[model samples]
Target: MKKSIVLISLIGLMIACSGEKKESTEETQITEEEVQNIEQSAQEIDAVIDSSIQEIDTLQNEIDDLLKDI
Candidate 1:
């Protein structure tokens, strides 16, 4: 019968459209050495920025002293 055929076709379509669940096969991890390297790089960058700021402050003070002399 046409109705039985249509019912069977709908059931096959549903099974084809259903998604399968999959488990993750591998886990990702960060090593201690990588963490230490990142921390060290951050500290070096901070030191460079602090030194540049101090240099700028010193130059500004020199300019102020020169203006006072004039």
Candidate 2:
């Protein structure tokens, strides 16, 4: 009786483990709209970064000019 109980418990555990593996192995599918949206977000981020770099360069040049005058 104990042996049967242990065997059944082990089988139940195995079934639970297999179910989890199937869920974990499933592939995620992204739609084309999602891809386009990601690309647009990336482009927006790049534009922001470019403008920030230009601003920093302008600030650095002004600082250098002020130092030269002093």
Candidate 3:
């Protein structure tokens, strides 16, 4: 679910950054810095996801150990 959500959000962001952007009353464009920032943000998100999965696995192992004792 988290991956799906992140994928969707990243896809949307990529689409938004892919083409010329113009506001209704003004001209606005996606900059190189914005794209770079998005890339960094995605990396950070992946790191958080990795850590979260690891924590969940650790907790699950602890739970399984307890179940085995009982």
Best by TM-score: 2
Report clash pairs, candidate 3: none
Give the alpha carbon lDDT tens digit for every residue of 1-70 in model 3: 9999999999999998999876598668899999999999999999999999999999999999999999
Tens-digit lDDT string for candidate 2 (34-58)? 9999999999999999999999999
Residue 65 in model 2: lDDT: 100
Pairs with backbone N, CA or C atoms under 3 Å apart (clashes), candidate 1: none
What is the per-residue lDDT of model 1 for residues 14-68, given as tens digits with 9 covering 90 to 100? 9988968788988988899999999999999999999999999999999999999
Any idea how many clashes model 2 has?
0
* Candidate 3 Cα RMSD after full superposition onto the native fold (Å): 19.1
Off by over 4 Å in 3: 1-25
Worst 10 residues of 1 by lDDT: 19-28
Consecutive 10-residue window with the lowest summed lDDT within model 3: 20-29
Off by over 4 Å in 1: 1-28
